[model samples]
Target: MDHDESPVLDALAEYHDRGYLDFAPPGHKQGLGADDAVRRVLGPEVFHSDVLATGALDDRRSSNRVLERAQELMADAVGAQQAFFSTCGSSLSVKSAMMAVAAPGETMLVGRDAHKSVIAGLTLTGIQPVWVRPRWDRELHLAHPPSPEAYDEAFAEHPEAVGALVTSPSPYGTCSDLKSIARVCHDHGKPLIVDEAWGAHLPFHDDLPTWAMDADADVCVVSVHKMGAGFEQGSVFHLQGDLIDPVRLKQSADLLSTTSPNVLLYAAMDGWRRQMVRDGRELLGSALRLAHAVRASIDELPGLRVIEKQLVAKEASHDLDRLQIMIDTLDAGISGYQAADWLREERAVNVGLSDHRRILAQLTFADTPERTDRLVSALGDLTRTSLPAPSSVVLPEPRDLELEQVMLPREAFFAAQETVPVEEAADRIAAEQVTPYPPGIPVILPGERISAGVIDYLRSGKTATMVIPDAADPSLKSIRVVADT
Candidate 1:
C-alpha cells in the first residue's frame, strides 16, 4: 500500500483534468448556475468539487473504485481490517455500527454517558440498551467512561446481549481502558463498538490515549473532522475481526446514508489520511507539547486550575487526553457558562465544552503557539472581570440522576404523548430527549421515568448557560411525556 497515493484526491484531479461536465441533481452544474452571492461566500472551488460520487467522481459504473481505494488506504493507515467513509458524521457512522452488531429488539450493553446520538439510535432501532454506569467523579460532577468491570457485570447479567458500545476520549477527553473493555466483550462472545469520535489522532501519537483499533475493538467510529484536518461531517468507521460481517456493516450504513454523497468530504478525508500517515506524528507531537504548556500556564493563573490528576485517578478515567484542557472555574467565583459567555462576547474567543463548573478548550494538531497564547490571554482576562452571578443549577446526586427506564425508547417516543407542566411531569415516562449541548448527553431520555431532581437540574441550568437544543420546549416550562394509559 503506497500511503503517498490518495485515491480520492487523485481521482478528483483527474475529474477536473478530463473536464467532465454534469447535468446532474446538484443543479449548480459546477457553479455556473450558482448565484454570484453564494459563490462569493462559499468560494467557487466548493461547488466545483461538489461532483456526484458515482457518475462524476468514479464514472457511472464506479469501475475506478475511487472511494473503495480511499477506504482501503484509511483502514491501512489506522491498522484496521476494513474501513467505511461517512459524509454524515460520526453520529450516522456510530448508528450504522450499532445496527450492524444488534438488530431491533436485541439487547446491547451501552454506557449511560453515551452521547444523545446513541440514545437516538436506540430509539430509532428499538435496540434495548442495558445501561452501564460510568465512573462518576462525584467531586467534579462529571462522568468518565464506564470501567471494564462494569461491562463484564452487564454481560454477566444479560448474557443475551448481542454486543457493547462505549465512548472513549469522551467529549471532555477522559478515556476508558479500551483494551480491557474489548477483552470483556470478547470473553462474552460479543463484539465491541467504540465510539472513538474524539480519537482520530490517537493512532498517530503514542503519548495519547490508546486508539480503539490498537485495543482490538471489533468496530470503531471516528470523526476525522474532530481531531484531524477534514471538512465537518467527515467521518470514518473501521472494522476488524470476523465478529462483525463487513457486508452487513456496509449495508447497515447504506440503509441510513444519503443517496447523494459529497465528493468534497470524501476528498478531504482521503487527503487527511495521506497527511496523517506522512506527517501526523510530528504534527501531533507538536500539539501535545503546546497543550502541556498551555495547561501549565492556565493552572498558574489565579482562581483557575486545569484538571488532570483527578481525571486519571484510580477510581476515575483510565486515561486522559491532555489536549482537552478542562479548566475548573469554581474558584474564580464564576460558572463555566459565565466564563464561556465572557470569552466569546468580550474576547471573541470560543471554548469547546462548558458546564456548571468547568470549561474545556480542545487542542488539535492545527493549534499553534499564537493561537494558544490568545486562549490563555482571554482566560486570564476572564478571571479578572467582575461578571454577573451565574444562576444556580440544582445538580442532583449521582444516584438521583439515574432515572429508571419504564418502557422501550421507541415505544415511548412514538406513543401518544402529552405536554405537561414541568412541576407535574415527575414520575411520568418521558417521550422526548432533553440534553445539554456541547457534551450532548441526555439527562432525560425517552422511556425513562422523569425525576423531580433531574427536572430541577435542567430547569435551573436552562436559566444559566445550558442550551437544550433537542427539548421540544427549550424553555423547560413544559415537557413531553407518554400519555397516561
Candidate 2:
C-alpha cells in the first residue's frame, strides 16, 4: 500500500482537470446557479467541490474504486482490518456499529455515561441495553469509563447480551482501559464496540492514550473532524477480527447513510489520512509539548487548577489525554457556564465542554503558541473580573443520578405521552431525553423513572445557565412523561 496515495483526493483533482460537466442533483453546477451572496460568504471552492459522490466524483458504477481505496488507506494508516467512511459523523457510525452486533430486541451491555447518540440508537433500534455503571468520582462530580470488572460482572449477570459498547476519552478526555475491556468482551465471546469519537489522533501519536484498534477492539468508530484535520461530519468506522462481519457492518451503515454522499467530506478524510501517515507524528508530538506548557501555565494562574493527577488516579480513569485542559473554576468563584459565557462574549474565546464547575480547552494538533496564548490571556482576564456568583445547581448524588429504566427506550419514546409540570414529574417514566449540551449526555433518558433529585438538579442547573437542548420544553417548567396505561 502506497501511504502517499490519496484516492479520493486524486480523483477530485482529476475530475477538475477533465472539466466534467454536471447535470446533477446539486443544481448549483459548480456555483453557476448559486446565489452571489452565498458564494461570496462561503467561497467558490466549497460549491465547486460539492459534487455528487457517485456520478461525478467516481463513475456511476464506481469501477474506479476511488472511495474504496481511500477507505483502505485509512485502515492501513490506523492499523485496522477495514475502514468505512461516514459523511454523517460518528453518531451514525456508532449506531451502525451497535446494529452490527445486536439486532432489535437483543441485549447489549452499554456504559451508562454514553453520549446521547448511543441512547438514540436504542430508541431507533429496539435494542435492550443492560446499563454498565461508569466509575463515579463523587467528590469531583465526574464519571470515568466503566472498568473491565464492571463489564465482566455485567456479562456474568446477563450472559444473553450479544455484545458491549464503551465510550473512551469521554468529552472531558478521561479514558478507560480498552485492552482490558476488550479482553473481557472476548472472554464472553462477545465483540466490543468502542465509541472513540474523541480519539482520532490517538493512533498517530504514541504518547497519547491507546487507540481502540491497537487495544484489540472488534469495532471502533472515530470522528475525524474532532481530533484530526478533516471537514466537519467526517467520520470513519474501523473494524478488525472475525467477531463482527465486515459485510454486515457495511450493510448496517448503508441502512442509515445518505444516498447522495458529499465528495468534499470524502476528499478531506482521504487527504487527512495521507497527511497523517506522512506528518502526523511530528505534528502531534509538537502538540503534546505545547499542551504540557499550556497546562503548566494555566495551572499557575491564580484560583485555577488543571485536573490531571486526579483524572488518572487509581480509582478514576485508566488514562488521560492531556490535550484536553480541564480547569476547575470553583476556586475562581464563578461557574463554568459564567466563565464560558464571559469568555465568548468578552474575549471572543470559545472553550469546548463547560460544566457546573469546569471549563475545557480542547487543544488539537492544529493549535499553535499564539492561539493558546490568547486562551490563557482570556482566562486570566476572567479570573480578575468581578462577576456575580452563579446560582448553585442542586447536584445529585451518584446513586440519585442513576434512574431506573422502567420500559424499553423505544416503547417509552413512542408510547402515548403527556407533559406535566416539573414539580409533578417525579416518579413518572420519562418519555423524552433531557440533556445538557457541551457533553451531550442525557441526564434523563426515555423509559427511566424520573426522581425528585434529578428534577431539582435540572431545575436548578437550568437556572444556573445549563442548556438542555433536547427536552420537549427547554425551559424545564414542564417535562414529557409516559402516560398511564
Candidate 3:
C-alpha cells in the first residue's frame, strides 16, 4: 500500500472531473438547490464534495475500495496492524473501542478523570467501570492522568475486568505513563485502550509524549480534527496486537455509526494521512518551536503564568504535550472565562479551553508565527486591561469529589427519573451527566450518588460562567435523578 496514494481524495477528484450528476439522498443536489445564504457562507465546494461514500466516491458496488485503501494507507503510515476511520469523531470511536474490549455486565478499568465521552461509553455499553483515581493536584485544583500503579490497583481489586482504558494528553495535554500501564494490562492478559483524541500529532513528532501505538496499546482512538489538518469530526481508531479482535471492533463501530457516511470527511482524512507521512516531522518540529517561544513569551507577561514544570512531576503527569499552552489566568486579576470572552470579543482571538482560573491556547502544525503573535498581543493587552475576576467556585477535596456508584450507569440513567430542585437532588442517583465543557470532563456521571458539595460546585461554577451543555438543567436550579422504585 502506497502511503502517498490518497484513494478517497483521488476518487473524489475523479468524481468531480467526470461531472457525475447524482440523484442521491443529499437533496441539495450539489449545492444548486441549497439555500443562497447557506451557499454564500459555506461555499459551493463543501456541498460539491459531499457525495455518497460508496455510490459516488467509489462506485455503486464500491468496486474501487477507495475507503479501504485509504484506511490501509493510514495503517501503514502509523505503524498499526489496522486503522479504521470514523466520520463521527473520536467520541464514537472511543466508545466502539470500549465495547469491543468489554461487553455488557463485564468490568473495565477506567480513569476517573476521563472525558464525558468515556462516561457515555460506560452508560451505553453497561460495562461495569472500575474507577482508577487520577493524580490530583490539590493546590492547582487539576487532575492529571492516573499512574500505572493506579491501573494495577484497579485490576487487583477487579481481576475479572476485561481491559483498561486511559485518556492521554487530556484536554489539558497531560499524558499518562502509557507504556507502563500497557505493560500492566498486558501482564494480566487484558487489552489497553487509549482515548487519545488530543494526540493526533503525537505520533508524527518524536519529541511529543509517547502515543498509544508506540506504547503497545491494543487500541487507540484519535481525533484528526483536533491536532491535524482534517475537518472537524474526522477521527481514526488504530489497532495493534492480537488482544482485540479487529472484526469485533468494526462490528462495534458499525453498531453506533451512521449508514450514510460523509465522503468529505473521508477525503480530508485520506489527504491528511498522506500529508503526515510526507512532512509531519518537519511541520510538527516547527509547531514545537513556536509553542516553546510562545510559552516563554506568555510567561514574561505580568500576571500570567505558563504552566509546564508543575504539570510534569512524578506526582503529577508522566509527560506533557507543550502544544497545549495552559496559562494560569487568576494572576491577571480576571477569571479565565472573562479572559476568554475578552479575547474573542475584543481581539477576535479564541483560546481552546478555559476554566475558573486557566485558559488554554492549542498550538498545531497549522499555526503560524503571525497567529501566535496575535494571541500574545491579545493576551498581553488582556493582562493590562482592568477586568474584575468572577466569583470563585468552591472546589471540593479530591476524596469528596469521588462520588460513590450504586448502580450501573445504563440502568440508573434509563430508569424512572424525576427532576428535583438542587437541594433535594443530593444522595439521589444521577440520571444524567453534568460536565464542564471545553475540557469536557464529567464531574457527576450517571448512577453516581450526587453530593451537596458537588452540586454547590456546579451551581457556583455556572453562576461564575461555567458552561455545562449536556445537563438537562444547566442552571443547576434542578437536576434529573433516578426515581425511587
Q: Could you give the C-alpha RMSD of every candidate to the true structure, in order shown?
A: 0.8, 0.7, 1.0
Q: What C-alpha lDDT, on a 0 to 100 scale, does residue 86 get in candidate 2?
A: 100
In model 1, the runs with Cα more than 4 Å from the true position are none
Per-residue error for 131 in candidate 1, Å, reads 0.4
Model 3 residue runs over 4 Å out of place are none
Off by over 4 Å in 2: none
lDDT of 3 by residue, 139-252 (tens): 788998889988998899899999999999899999999999999999999999999999988888899999899999999999999999889999999999999999999999
Candidate 2 lDDT over residue span 55-97, tens digit each? 8888899999999999999999999999999999999999999
Predicted structure 3, TM vs. truth: 0.99
TM-score of each: 0.99, 0.99, 0.99
Q: Tell me the lDDT of candidate 2.
A: 0.94
lDDT of 3 at 293: 98
Each candidate's lDDT (Cα)?
A: 0.93, 0.94, 0.92
Position 330, candidate 1: lDDT: 92
Give the better candidate number (2 or 3) by TM-score.
2
Candidate achieving higher lDDT, 1 or 3: 1
Cα-based lDDT at residue 342, candidate 1: 90
